[model samples]
Target: MAELSADAAWNYVYCQGWNRDLQRFVGLLDSDTACARNEAGEQYSVTLLRGGVPRVVIDIAWSAHYLGVWTLDEALRRDSHVDYRRLRAEQLFPVRERVWRYAEGQRDGDDDVWEQEVSRKANGWMSTSKRPRGRLGGSSRTAGQEDDTDIWREVPVFGDWRWALPDKEAGPVGTAAEHTGEYEAVSAGSPWRPPTPYRNLYLDDLMLEGATVLMEGAQPRVVAHRLRGMVDMPTGQVITCEPRWLDYSEPFTDTIEPGRYEVHDVLLTDPDSESDWWPRAGFLLRVSEAPVVSWEMALRAGEDPRTLSDGDFYGFSGSQGCFVDAEPLRTADHQINADRGREQSYALRKWARMAKRGELHEHPHSQWSDALERGLDDRDGIRLPGTNFNMIAYNCYYPDGSYPTWIGRATDGAIVCFLTDMRTTHPVIATDH
Candidate 1:
């Protein structure tokens, strides 16, 4: 096992989570604690500490989401090597004014249209705190320490900020080919499998040929128009493909481009509902060479509700005088629903930040570029220069909730986020590696 030096010890703790009671970031202190070897004879240990004091020890070698101890160190070394001061600092938006404007603006520009709304707090019309939670940068100070630069001076993180991809598709539906995979045939337990409509039809029956162009008219025609799956986006259409074949007998020369066409149709397969299941159901397939990366994060309030300022509110807000100031937040009545609205707000903020920093690996397609252009002012939605964390704060109307998502590297050197508001903030470690 590799011995931990001062820098190595710092890397381990810097990627872990922050300890609220300790009043400082937490991480592993020494290298000897990580000497325990797994069945593979690999040394692995993840110890979280508060001010060089051990708090929680996780044996990541044999635990879930294990990527080996060496990987953890490599990621940490890469993240810590960068001089954050040298990188261009991101500009921060005026969050308080934006949320206030949204709250004050009526549905139809009239006062009584939606009058029950109000701002949560009037404090700090602009939360200009250089650091998160009014605390100094990570690795700056410890619990009892006085000097800001006494603990450490560098911003410890894991490699350049990159988007981690999901392990599997978000949807549950699978195709016939997936059912016939080697694992599916030998698996012991049976899952509640949804029937694939095209399971009966095998690939041989479809007789799909590779790139067989049938005609070359104004709109080039193809032998088979592949109908994958459908995706629903905010502005227009988002589509997903599952290898289903659809026959495009009619001439789509007018609507489609010159390239190969992938035609899709809106289908309703819900048996439970007597009414039409395809109410406003739509199908759109937009294929682009431009790359796309997707990931998910659980968002939550990190600081005490009382300490949060007006700028903390991100997306939507209530009116200034009409709504209860702190009742919603204090009573936990304003928690953002992760599945419904939080994801949309997160994607908005994340992509905007990535684009502005020029860290986005894949060049966005025209559609995505257009969407980003529309929200350009949000380039620094919940982030500031020199701060170790990136945040995504927004509000939803129907559910009447506010979401302040915190994203940052922990002392342990993992890219993680704090989703929910507990007495202590726990890092939801990202496992894309």
Candidate 2:
């Protein structure tokens, strides 16, 4: 129950889904506002966000040690003591286009072609922007705003960015595990009654099912949603609830390094189907790709379509696009699904003002030496970025990579990250913590 400094107030950011988790969390911090700094040497406010969003940035007088380094991989870490409630600005920040991500190859029996399904928007051939706008760096200014998806300004853009889901698995009928610890085994016999009626979002398929690994060399670990569960507040007969889960059995894009094997595969019993008895006929889920993180394997050249449950879990192609454009946004026509082709890469170009170019701090972020020696560019050779109340902008030269950074400290001296800038921009407070 902390408060913001008089100079700052909690600014509102957009919510990802229509879930009540955000609204209730807002009530917790009176809007758990945050403050963090960017390379602009200015302080801004931000609403912390979760998932593949921006790292919460606060308005700090000081920048981090890697402020002038050219490569990424040096700026990865967890948050510490900073007044997250008292934010640095309102929105979140986008990547500098240095850090990048993409879909890896599909495995045997991966029915869903994640890459092909999500490629239309990756190349910039078409779009759905009414104003022909590109990307929305979460924190925006009117006149300063233009249709520039490829442009990197250290600002938070809230548009379309997705944590590529898992590839479906081909398997036998998956069984459902009871919501085990949810309620202590009540009755000794059959009809076990409940204590206090608390509504649990225990989807029949999501109740921790068994897994079967299809890939011969793949890891057989049965990993799926890490921290799983929902929060429910009873409302008389019915209960209101919000869902949250640490689905850590994420798929990797196969950046198979030395000895470390990439983790993939999730045991999910897909719900719903044309069948009446098993209305959700596809009860079992043993996709070729492991969990989401495991699919974070090294981006390959031909990681197109893999079949799992005969359905499609979309994916994006073209390297480094995640840091800038929302690719393959949608190919088919809203009215005519058949006419749709691909989501063209909405461009986001970056060019410094005449004066700013000469003094470009090419190697602005240099904290991690190993990356420095390797000579990696901030997504697109960006140095200094733009800033505002809740964001910073990284002007991107290439639409591929992302320039990741260390978010700053808010007032009152406490640290907590509300935004996570993996690709798209803007910071909404993360409801988990």
Top TM-score model: 1
Over the stretch 37-119, how does candidate 2's per-residue lDDT look in tens digits?
23343222222222222223222222211111111111222112111111124321121112122224432223332211111
Compared with the true structure, model 1 gives a TM-score of: 0.19
Query: Can you tell me which runs of candidate 2 are displaced by over 4 Å?
Result: 1-122, 129-150, 154-276, 281-433
- Name the weakest run of 10 consecutive residues (lDDT summed) in model 1: 78-87
Q: Residue by residue across 51-160, what tens digits does model 1's lDDT show?
A: 23333323222221122111112111101010011111221111111111112333222233211111112222212112221121321221221222221222212221
What's the residue-level lDDT of 275 in candidate 1? 51
List per-prediction Cα lDDT, in the order shown: 0.23, 0.20
